[model samples]
Target: MWIIFGILTLIMTLLNLYMYNAGKNYHIFMVLSLFLMALTLCDQYQMIASWSLAGDWSAIADVAPTLSMILWIFVIGSFVVNVIPLLLSYRKNR
Candidate 1:
């Protein structure tokens, strides 16, 4: 599973880079894909961490705080960075 997710992340990252350089409007898709990949990795990490803890996971909620934080931050940030501009421009253009 980890290997699969790692490969997926790599593929998405590569796709993002290619899309970026292709001079196409791909930021939205690229960011979404990257964010999803990141979240998937974070979830995988949490699963591993949970298994490692095994009924003794101290402060389970605290484990991999950064993972969730980073996931949501990137998700929301990407939306703000990409969508807001599109919206503003759309409104302005209209």
Candidate 2:
């Protein structure tokens, strides 16, 4: 999951950069996506730390309050924000 998020985040970040450079006025979505991507990276770090300390397969899977879910929410929300604005723009242009 982390790897998947990481790759998606990279792609989105690049797209965001392009959009911003193109003067699309989509700063909020860009910033939100960037933040979520950073959060995903942090979650990956937490997982690594937990695994290293536990040194046991079972304990690695038992860590509570994992931040993965929250990160997912942020990712999905960012996507929604990006899509909604584009949709609104499309409707207006039509």
Candidate 3:
């Protein structure tokens, strides 16, 4: 599941980069996508370490999950913000 998510985020980051270069006003999406990719990588690392060490999860317990959760919140918030403008514009046009 993590691998699948990582792949999906990787694709999103790539698409954002493409959109950013193709035109204007996509900088925020690109930046957020990059941030999400970084967070996903960090989460993957933490998961690997936790699995390898088995009973030593305490070492990363203080920070990893909390930071990941915070990043997820930001990612979701940004997605909502990005979608709202488009939805409003579509509604206005209709």
Candidate 4:
């Protein structure tokens, strides 16, 4: 459920922050966040598709499109935050 997703996301975010602050590679956690977000979106899409199959128009209507948009934003934001430092560090080391 969303509660589980929230907890996992929170843990990942904390790990990412710690790694970032320590100047360690945080790309792995960013990748994990992207994977998690994709999985959740796919699951949500499947659920919505099932609702349509069941002729439950109301269920589809109830799904806020903004929710998925928000997820996309967060995943993309994580990539931006993690990747810049990773690239910068790589270049500096080289």
Candidate 5:
């Protein structure tokens, strides 16, 4: 199930990147895809950690908490970047 989520997230990210490169208006989608990917990474990390601590390495779990944390940081940064422009434009119009 988690693997499926990861794969979907990866696909979304790639699609967003392609759209971005193609000069399409998909900044919001890019940000959202990144956020989802970050969440999936965090979930995968937790699953891996639990399995490792229980000494159950054969369960085929994915880990890497540090990487997940980094991704979360990126997500937050990207969210801010995505929102600030909209806020500025709104304020300017008002």
Candidate 6:
């Protein structure tokens, strides 16, 4: 679930970038990016909760934190990549 959401988020982010470049209305993509990001976070938390319930201490300890960190980085990096170009274009237009 988390992996699926993560991949969707990446694809949406790329679509956002493409929309920006094409001078299309990318606001819907922006909204979808944020929505997908939230879904991904929820999926990650659910995964951690399942591991905790199953008493998988090793996975909880060894994987969860690091995976969360990587997820955050990927989300932020993709978001910035999508938004910065739009910002630049706005300033360029002005």
C-alpha-based local distance difference test score of model 1: 0.59
lDDT of 3 at 23: 54
TM-score for predicted model 5 compared with the true structure: 0.46
Cα lDDT, all candidates: 0.59, 0.65, 0.62, 0.69, 0.62, 0.83
**For model 1, how does the per-residue alpha-carbon lDDT over 1-94 read when each residue is reduced to its tens digit?**
6456545655655565565457556565556655666676676677857766686555555655665686566556544544544465577679
* Residues 1-94, model 3: lDDT tens digits: 5566556665665565556456556556656665665667676677757765786656567656786786577567546644554465567679
| Candidate 3 RMSD to the correct structure | 7.1
Best by TM-score: 6
Total residue pair clashes for candidate 3: 0
TM-score of each: 0.43, 0.45, 0.43, 0.67, 0.46, 0.86
Q: Distance from true position, residue 69, model 4, in Å? A: 3.4
Could you tell me the TM-score of candidate 6? 0.86
Pairs that collide, model 6: none
Candidate 6: stretches off by over 4 Å: none
Stronger candidate by TM-score (1 vs 2): 2
For candidate 4, the 10 contiguous residues with the lowest summed lDDT are 1-10
Candidate maximizing lDDT:
6
Descending-lDDT candidate ranking: 6, 4, 2, 5, 3, 1
* Model 1 collision count: 0
Q: What is the lDDT of residue 8 in candidate 3?
A: 63
Give the poorly placed runs of model 1, Cα more than 4 Å off. 53-94
lDDT of 2 by residue, 5-92 (tens): 6667666766765675576776665666666677776777777687878786565565434655755676676567556556766777
1-94: candidate 4 lDDT, tens digit per residue: 6546645665676677678779887877867765666666676677778899999987677675766677677667656755666677778889
